[model samples]
Target: MPNVIEALQPTLEGAAMRAVFALPQPLRRLIAGPPIRIDDQELALDAQLLLKLQKLTGQTGLSAETAAKARAGMARATKITAGSPVPGVVVAERSIPTDDGDLPARLYRPREVTETGPLLVFYHGGGWVIGDLDSHDDLCRFLAKHAGIRVLSVDYRLAPEYPFPAALDDALAAYHYAVDNAADLGSSSDAIAVGGDSAGGNLAAAVALRTTRAGEQKPVFQLLLYPAVDATRRRRSRELFGNGFLLTDHDMTWFMEQYSPQESTLADPRLSVLLADDHSDLPTAYVVTCGFDPLRDEGEAYAKALSDAGVPVVARRFPDLIHGFANIRPVGHRFEEALFEIVGTVRAALELHKG
Candidate 1:
């Protein structure tokens, strides 16, 4: 990882001062002792959670070497506590058809649809090996309420059981299902958008590309937040931000080890969207990144490549945020701002799709 000094540079003197300054006191000590974030006392709670997990699993402790498969299984369930429900939005459990079987899905819709809006198919982030619909429940609700659109959250099967193509297959299946069943789901917009964080973002991009190739309708927009788009693990971000960050090199390597194809699928562009031959026909996109995140550079590179390919791209780098920050709005105020930004982007994309 970049030395502590370099990584903290952007936020050291400015907006990120809080998260940065706390590093020495709360962050640094936590590495060898215990994690404590001055900005949020709850971080101490996370350290405790790690300690508990470590003890239960019979592992040494919560360190960079924790096994990802165990982590995924341990994180099987994610609960989202609502601050308050948006007046018109309702979150309901549902099913989406896929080639393998009927996959689980959650549908979120604004309370009222005065007119047609946009349909968003969202995937959750958990490095492909972890995460689920429940894990990202808050994000879906916030998007539906704030963006004023119908959001279909897909619960694609994870890796080591389903593996790489399995999640990718489910993602495409869910998108097509949303397209075909939009009316039944009370979706007003004909144009569909797909989004997700981390691994989910990878699936979203893959679905878009696959849809285009299959002659299926493309999503009107793509929203990728700190997406793990490259499976090859050759990027500078992979090397530079490999350690100390919330997401460490070992954790990523473990995730990749669990989710990757058995043989030579690593080179497949579908697996690594960054290596795709062309980004030309893809939908307009909003790529979000956390300044301290290891995946930051590749995401920025993808945005630039998309722009270069003639696709309209909007990139937002939150210097004060960390990876997976969007999943914890209750923990940090920045989460709320990020939610609003996502809503704005979705609304604008829907409007453009209409025109």
Candidate 2:
């Protein structure tokens, strides 16, 4: 088995392009953060990769500092199609009521909007601290356009202020509101699904469990992008890939600290669905993992648990990808291929539920 660093090197092709074979780890860390060694591949730490991220940031014609600042206030990520635009599938902004206040959300509909297209509720990744709709905008638009589905990007409250059940509550509320108001949004109430990347994915899974417990129909399927399903921070993967990846043990600890008001909530099943008593009644799932991420093992573990409990679960590990590669769709061929594969998976999953 290779180390985490080895697993992540390839994903840095553009950055490491034409580089020497034996550069020191520290230099790489300064340039690209850390990589987790798993089997033969290496995974880059998400934050560092994004910070050192070159092409997408440049192509978007936005400075990293400026883009990061704008992201602080937004909710869901998004992008629009060009050339022969769809008549009605404009990316629009709106808010849904939560117990505390209005939770911001983005709606993406394609042209020829069916009075009831399947809807996907999306959450952005930021370790519960940094991301917003602006960060993930491109991916959501791609999914909506490619899958012929409606995508609602949720901007739930972040940590250090809202914390824990606050975000969870917001996610649940947004979901129900979307379902109840599906017609107004021009989507089928019965076709709603929930999903997110990293922390958002964890929230989506928890929402699915809570919704089922409350006797609501589970979302059609969960589309989890390398979700952080366990908060314990004790898994071997955590220890192994903990330091070098863009998400280090320190960073995750920071995120957990910010997101959980009480330290004990780290063990709460709502925060760590992998610790839940049963995953049997949850919706079908498509869980994606990165070979080099610290959360890789736990994501796979949750998928296995779901499968073992008789829930239909499909898992994919992108051996050559890093944690936030899903957000960098326009950068590399690998991202484009992965993006299409993701949409195809959702399309297939939704079709099954429809039948």
Candidate 3:
């Protein structure tokens, strides 16, 4: 039956993915290289893979249809190249009903977690436009397995269709859902966290701010990975690393236009979280930034803001890497190292909660 086939798809795909990664590491490198250098930063081996991807998907322009198709192809390629799922991580697909609609989500749990534990409600990054649950599936699985925490990847509505508060709404909805139904999702309600990379990071920060303001049960921790905290993009890093990096200023402009067509809304705290009046009382945060990301300064600025507000904050910046480096598989040991560091941070944060 179609339903049976649909249900079996992830298993089949995951198995195939594992086999592909089982090949010799040298061979994998050969397939994904040779690396290119841009400015002072040497591009990762995955840059070649991205070039091939660009050829396959064309320019991706500003159109929704082109972007969607390109995103799908990129996700497929990422899965093939992302090595394999972390061993002993169990994945399941589920739909959480929101006031807007039934929001699809994927849940990842470590095999050791037979009882309730920490839960990370994650939003996938695509500049609020071009990502979904599948796009960041491998990262979620890696975090869940390595950090020994449950990860719920939400498929929030994308922009040029939903726009602005829509994605924010879905993100907040998912976080609340996790808080309310933590037991059902195999997590302790008190140990819930919210995190995301890039635009999803923006959403996570916004949700954390709003939750604190609402006098609600706030998330225990915040994990912001290269979040786009400033919609204005006026920082020196934006000009310094705006081009040649994996994400260009042109692409960022396109994404911004799609997400917030009105220039007036660009300064709104929900969109530009760094512009928020008060950062006091936010949860402890782990903020990651890449040297070659245009959004790097804003992310650091946010961390500084949180620290100034007396919120415990851990901020790490990778000087040799570009935007989206943490999610790319073909980037070699550097990528693995960065990812492991992130997972370790998550583990430590959860353990503190347990204590």
Candidate 4:
């Protein structure tokens, strides 16, 4: 016999999330309290409410749980918030063969597009620990439908078990597989893009650098959403917006330790992409950051370095949004609005190429 309150905890939680958006915008704003100002930017009403709700839940950090528990909690959270998969997009489960074994993947496309075109090789964000293909399924579907291109969402190995370089190795392998089997995957080998959010974005940036330095075929574009580009930097954003935000500085530290146990590797360009001496020769990039994110400074720094290196880059920071907003659509108008603008930019940059 479960306690009645405990039995209804999930139901109550889900209802609370819905109730926030169910209210009139004015009332929601009122409950969200005053605008949270930091670094000359105002936090959006929706962000404040979500953070409040998060506080009520008392979920301070995933580091408190084992990696397995953290993953389970993340999956449950996604189920509560991510909503349904967008329709009219076909999804096919794929097994991308890697040196270690077969890597799981999901290929997404508009149901109408049967012919070959450009494709985005995507990675999911979980600080190299929690996220998986299922957690990011709606995100992939949203991108495929809205961006009007194919997306291959790869499930790379997680850390604390398969640590540094394993995920990157799997990422490189998936990209090469897409290139080698472009026809089968319905993508133009020369028009492929590499993209992801957070840790996934880190992998994408690393893949681009690794490929270019090796003189191999590289992605034509990079979609980096609030990426952890500098692992070693102690920036101001971390001090200001580190706690109370969706992602905490302590969480980042714990995640990095689990992923890259070697303190020596923190300075490696592959891990700390901002440490790369030259940002030249990298693919065209769209770097997105939010004013309230712990990774904001590093992401912006990477974008500036890229632009200074003469690479064509579109860097935009949504003044009011928080980190991980890209995948938190279906929760509120603000989240959906921000993601809409982002995919619009992605569509413009990685437009489908008929080849």
Candidate 5:
């Protein structure tokens, strides 16, 4: 009976979440407390409720725990939030050849492919400390199913175990592996893109810049979801929405500390991609930021930097959403809607690139 209840947990949670989201916006806002307005942006009703639920349940963050424990906690949380895998997307276990042992990877392929179509090499976001392929599984599936593009989800080494340059180097290695094997992956070399949320987003941006300057195969596109572009400085968002917004500044500091313990390593452009000297002629990019996220300003700043550098970039801000919304789409109707919109944007961008 216990096992059965455990198995039915996601279903139960899903139903409850759906019921909450089904409520009228005003009701949700009322339940989540009065409208939360900051920086001239009002929090969306759904986002407010989600945060309220988290706070009520004492489910803020796991920053104070050991890396091992935090990782385990993250996995359990992913199970509840990921909901169910979408149908029609084929998932396969694969390995990315890297010097630091073969990294585990999951390839998400749409039922049909053009062989020369776009393929996004994705890194799961956990501030480079906690998340894994499983945490971002549903996201990969949705991207593949909705955008009609293949997704290569890489499980790069985490921090405090494999610090700073380790993840970045491994990410580059995985991207190189993808480039060399794009044909076998049912995608062309020119159609491959790099993407991730938060830490993963930081990796994608770094990888793109590295490949561009290092005379390697350049990626054609980038899909950065609230990337942590500059960890060196704090922007207004950090102070405004630092607490009760799902991703707290305390957690952010802890994550970065775990990723790069050595104080000297903080200034490296690979860790803070926004500090990189150049950002021109890299790849077409779609950068998504959340209005209530601490990392929002840094992400937008990076997007602006990319645009000023003459790169074709689209920067979208979900004014009512909070950070890490993509991973919680299962029960979050508003998040699901925003995600689909992002998928459509990706599809259109890829189509135009192919033209």
Candidate 6:
């Protein structure tokens, strides 16, 4: 990974292309105190985020250790700018026992809860290498508050250290724990769902598949936000948006290397849900994809697979945004709108299950 200065020092051709693709909002924000909103267009924050990320990456590089620090720092900054916590949501820390050890968890409960509210087991995204409960705390709070559902954010073990089956094991264990102990968490076991973004999204989908294969009680729903369904990275999106977007193809490869170094593991359904033999009889899915994200094609593909297998699925794409836009508050109203859309979908899905 290039340093901040090195990364931002693009070649003449690349610089020219960037200038052509850059949006005026980010440029305006650079000069002025706030972003100048023009017409509603896609790539609204592309230039802004891209520039910020380039500087951060340039300073920190993409080494595992540095990336972890950078991610932590960014999460802290995001929290500061995330404004106040959503009202009517109660948050509590939890320790969920897994086969390996005790996994840290955070429970977000809506104030207006009934005897049987829906529970969403959420996993945070960090390419299975970075991220934790803190990174996604705000998003979870918003979901719990606006979606009117309880959210259990699992802090699964990351890669290089734990690797492959570890995170998956943790995810599955957390799901089962939520199901068996749902009542204790003030949610109904039958109304439980699984959700996550990126690598976390992959884990959520894998858990759903594993549950289906085991003939266990399937989750009521699966909410995948820009999930990496294909570990093989064969999707065309990898080549298209793999460069300038927040998550690069190189970053994806780095993550895969850290998580599953062995090429043989690529085909494992737990690692690559898209390669699973059966997608039928899982659960209803709400898949979100970003047009500029390298994982977009695979996420959409997974959604299509679910729909083909007779599962009720809703796939929505935000053409203007990049990967991880949901967590970046600086992206402006588009981020809030997208987050609300996601929460709305979760609410509607849970309601349908209740009905």
Q: Judged by lDDT, which candidate is best?
A: 5
For the record, the alpha-carbon RMSD of candidate 4 to the native fold, in angstroms, is 1.9
Q: Which residue pairs in candidate 6 have backbone atoms (N, alpha carbon, C) closer than 3 angstroms, thus clashing?
A: 3-58, 4-58, 4-59, 43-320
- In angstroms, the error of model 4 at 57 is 1.6
Estimate every model's Cα lDDT from 0 to 1: 0.72, 0.74, 0.81, 0.88, 0.89, 0.80
lDDT of 5 by residue, 234-332 (tens): 899999989889899889999989999887778789898888899989899999999999999999999999999999999999999999999988877
| TM-score for predicted model 6 compared with the true structure | 0.85
How well is each residue in 32-126 modelled by candidate 6, as lDDT tens digits? 23432322434655434444545553532233445566466555445433545677888999999977999999999887775668899999998
Q: List the residue pairs that clash in candidate 4.
A: none
RMSD of every candidate to native, in Å, equals 9.6, 9.1, 4.9, 1.9, 1.7, 7.0
Q: What C-alpha lDDT does candidate 3 achieve relative to the native structure?
A: 0.81
Query: Which wins on TM-score, candidate 2 or candidate 3?
Result: 3
The estimated TM-scores of all candidates read 0.78, 0.79, 0.85, 0.95, 0.95, 0.85
How should the candidates be ordered by TM-score, best one leading? 4, 5, 6, 3, 2, 1
lDDT winner, 1 or 3: 3
Candidate 5: Cα lDDT at 42: 93
Q: List ranges where model 1 is wrong by over 4 Å.
A: 1-88, 261-263
Model 1: how far residue 304 lies from native, Å: 1.4
Model 6 residue 184 lDDT score: 95
For candidate 6, the per-residue lDDT at 314 reads 95
Q: Measured by TM-score, how close is model 4 to the native structure? A: 0.95
